[model samples]
Target: LAKTTQPISMDSYEGQEVNITCSHNNIATNDYITWYQQFPSQGPRFIIQGYKTKVTNEVASLFIPADRKSSTLSLPRVSLSDTAVYYCLVVRYNQGGKLIFGQGTELSVKP
Candidate 1:
């Protein structure tokens, strides 16, 4: 797994959109970029994944630049409930389908 770097914290008022970016300079060929969202007490929930270009789901949109060295997670119309820690993990297919975790970005949704 490749180590990723992301912002420690971000402040956003309720109903505003928030974008969290991550950088992974040495990602392996087999590694896939995956994003997760974590509220204070609960475990992270899968937000999105991408190998190239863009991928979007109900929760967020992932934008991977041409270099693939960094990516962005875009949260639209965020609200107080959207306040959570965002994690970016470089995951590769592994035995038993297990994946590793990297320190994530903590997003504070203000009211």
Candidate 2:
């Protein structure tokens, strides 16, 4: 299994975009990348996910390069309410692996 890695913290101003990068150097072929955002009291919510290239939705976009060793989660025009902890998770296609928490990037959106 590839070791998931993310920055401890990041800073951004309101109305600006924030991109958080996660690195999985030993990512397997069947692995998938997913991101989740968590507020103070609520559980983490899904942001975006991708296997390769790009995946976009109403709230966020996920970018995976050809190597698949790393991924970028892009949130557009963030607000103060967007300040939260973002988690990057790796899931296997058929292999039921345990999902680990605590390794996530904390994004602080300032006004």
Off by over 4 Å in 1: 94-97
Error (Å) of candidate 2 at residue 9 is 0.4
Question: How much lDDT does candidate 2 score?
Answer: 0.89
Which candidate number has the best lDDT?
2
lDDT of 1 at 44: 79
lDDT of each: 0.86, 0.89
Over 1-33, each residue of candidate 1 has an lDDT whose tens digit, in order, gives 678999999999988888898999988777789
Cα miss at 103, model 2 (Å)? 2.4
lDDT of 1: 0.86
lDDT of candidate 2 over 1-111, digit per residue (tens) = 677899999999999989999998888898888888989889889888899999999999999999999999999999999999999988885877566665689899998
Model 2 worst lDDT run, 10 consecutive residues: 93-102
